[model samples]
Target: MSYKLIPPGKRRNRHYWLRGTIAGERVEVSTGCETRQAAQAWAADYVARLEGQRVPGIGEVVAFERAAELYKAAHPHLSKSDIRLVGAVAKYFRNKGKACHEVVHADLVAAADELKPGRAASTKNRKVIGPAAAVLHYAANNQWCTYQRIEKFWVSRKSNREPARDEDLAVLIANVEAPPRRKKFGRKADYNVAFKRLLLLMLYELGLRIGHLLTVRWDDVDLRAARLKVRIPKSDEIASLELSPVIVSELANLTSATGVNRPALGRGVDRRGRLFPWTTNRGVHAWLKPLTDRLGIKYTPHMSRHKLATDAQVLPDKKAAELGVWKDPRSLHRYQHVRPEAIPGRSAATLLALPAPDKRKAS
Candidate 1:
């Protein structure tokens, strides 16, 4: 086992960073000491423990909080939301600072239970158990503790959002209030209402997550090419989607009316600005809720996504998955919701009611 002292960069902290390696597994930690000798001593002890060397009371054990930091450092490619969720789980155990070996199956179960109230099972699992399992798995891999307990936690649920029906969508569109367009001497007014309508239309037409949609910039749209550059927030990947004629037309009008020239709309589009600047995701939802409620439609931005996914069932599974940016085709199953009104009232038993002619056929 050996240790290396790494100098800090970007972060203007005075303390030196220490990296320890043992049996091909390396862990980098902050020594919290300025002197090289003290840092080296700390790394030596950490390496020895990770190597399964017992020193009296201190054995192969890492605090959950520290382990979380280590895990985060190890996975730099995790998305912003993913990092936040992991941090939330880590912060939950900050006060306790429980050691890896000290964590029991019941503790995880209790955590899951705590998250279960008022939250969807899927949400609870994804936010709580998932991160907890990851932390525990990291601990197990480092020989800090065994991971047999992770198997005990299992959380899943049917998807909450359902596809919006065509009729319902029509109602929503009809209910959408158009923004007041005041063209005084060819000057444009605030396009907030028009933008909201177009945003809803795009969300329905193209199955995009609201988070991804809201971050779209002018640079991301290609009007002449009829393509849109979409950034997937979960995977941090850029995907291209072909624009429909209606969408293309609307976008062209929007750009012309509000493009970087008008005083009202040109406030922020200096270099690279958002197409619809709402500031927060909550603001997007707040703008949407009134129209949906007025229409009496059980709808959300995600429901619009489901609507598009359901409509894309005619496409091949792979094609559908690709369009929806789903990593696995099975993930598409959750979005395959048929409108309740579309279901035929006649059951198979009723539809295939044949006469009892078979009884006389033998004769």
Candidate 2:
């Protein structure tokens, strides 16, 4: 029963036209009404005239599940994470069997709110609300439903996680155990200690997301040029990062001692050879936890990203964004987690002095 009030073409009827189905036929009739509401009223009357007449074409209703499927099918460019998110949302709504027109803003908000208990605001927005909106927008574009805007969930500027310090990192790397001797004759030893050390340094220096860090291939490293190519999974972009001499030496020695470009760790190596050679991101996280606990410092993979962004804030905005592989300058706020004392300024209390008259008044 949906109808659209279309504006007049240059043919100059100079009136709103009703475009939809009437009596099982697609109709494009001038409503002769100046106001959109009146045109809609006339269209409603037209539909009423088609009551019990088996209107066939534009009156067809689509199920929510079908529309969601269509929406996902339409966007082949969506990243793996985005595809997972959209699929999660689709799974939630698959049982409801609601038509596209029946889905409203309240329904979307309720779905987003359902995620609030388990997820942070940013995650709720990104994983749930964002995908729901995309589906609705797609349906609207096909004229199956009206588009309702969903507001992105707000996140606080403050984060509980602090940055991992370079000093602590250096200490941790220095204290890691040396590799044991190979038992077999003529069998080359794997450098686990050296490998972990280089991994930690690269994590602290490169500021890559954990997924990207875990998947880095040996071929991506260019030691002679002092550069590394990191595949950023979220942005679907490859970032070329400059490497320091310390990072270069660590990588060179680790590769040289193992006598291979692939990580000596057997299970995680692909044909291309990953750098860390950990089977999963969780394995890498678990491996690093013991070292951080021993060093008496809190550490997470993301803290390294925060440390990088915090340190680079001194540079210009564009430069900092480039360093962090950020497309938007505003995204810097998400990565920066500087302590109050670390901010570049004297405190307001120190910068401003009380007037001498205040003492006189007290006396």
Candidate 3:
């Protein structure tokens, strides 16, 4: 078929585009580049993938909704926050009342264009940028419309910052460590000690999202394997995680006191299976803000993720993917809170190192 020139590379002069199959069919295809040789090579390989029914060179055409459904399937192991982000995208787009079948790249771009620079820029980051890009990227992969890049028009450049130093984070952790505030007669002391301890262990050591951590049930943990299964809510994927021995011991200690540390002045009733049963999302922020205030740690729940993704992610294309932060670094501004301390590398780790991701038997 014919090819259209499109802006290439995410950031700068990476102006390149590919020619893929016609809309709607699954047959793999690819074409177009500065050099005819490169185009021919990609085209040849794309046809091979199509013929074998392998992962085809995809197009960039599906609307936001269609693409998101595919993204959910692709990332069966996303974290809870990621699920929230996907949900946000779906809600925002659907709320517009535009038909999913009729939406196009122009509609998405027009939507992105409507975002104001000085706006609160809070929810827009995760809602508009991260998941929104995922919807587009998936389509681009399928040859939707040579996706140029995802822009962060929501976040003003004023608030962005480099990764928060771990040393700084440690300082913040210490401030909030006064043996859990408790009530003696009628005062409201530290709300929940065991849960707070668990939260810190997760943020500092386990690198878990507060949302997912709150959803964690005792059953998901494999003590023998020393791993936790972080199920990505949006994509419905399950990612295996490694726990440092220190956190494991801390969790073990807390489990021992589950009933002893129960609320209600005497003994807190331990729920049967759920590892944590938070009454609301307020507790997380309530403790974190006060803790950070006392410790002088200037960060939020997601800041830990950003810190972890930046520090831990060591692989290309993996830093964002594994951390479930953003589809690409450009959208980083909107979801800076999700920035991870580490970018996992391909050759180094095996947490999500599964073979034949697309071909694996349904679980």
Top of the candidates by TM-score: 2
* Cα displacement (Å) at residue 82, model 2: 3.6
* 178-281: candidate 3 lDDT, tens digit per residue: 43435686554443555665565566554556676777666676655667776655445676777665555555556323344322122335534656546446
Candidate 2 Cα errors over 4 Å, as ranges: 1-61, 77-81, 113-123, 178-190, 256-272, 335-363
- Model 1 lDDT-worst window of ten: 342-351
Model 3: runs farther than 4 Å from truth?
1-162, 177-191, 255-271, 277-280, 312-363
Worst 10-residue lDDT window, candidate 2: 354-363
Error of 3 at 316 (Å): 5.0
Per the 3 Å backbone cut-off, how many clashing residue pairs does candidate 3 have?
Answer: 48
RMSD of 3: 19.3
Off by over 4 Å in 1: 1-59, 77-88, 91-97, 114-120, 147-149, 152-156, 178-190, 255-271, 336-363
Q: lDDT score, residue 303, model 2?
A: 82
lDDT of 1 by residue, 1-363 (tens): 566888655672777797667645676778787777887787777776675432213245577877787788888888788789888877777766778778777776667676556776667678887888898888787787786656543444256577765555555554465334467677455446457657777876676888888888888888778788988856667999877767776666664234443222234334357777675789887757766665556778888667666665356666677777766666766543632111112111211133322211111
In the range 122-159, model 2's lDDT, one tens digit per residue, is 87777788888888787777777777776776777666
lDDT of 1 at 334: 55
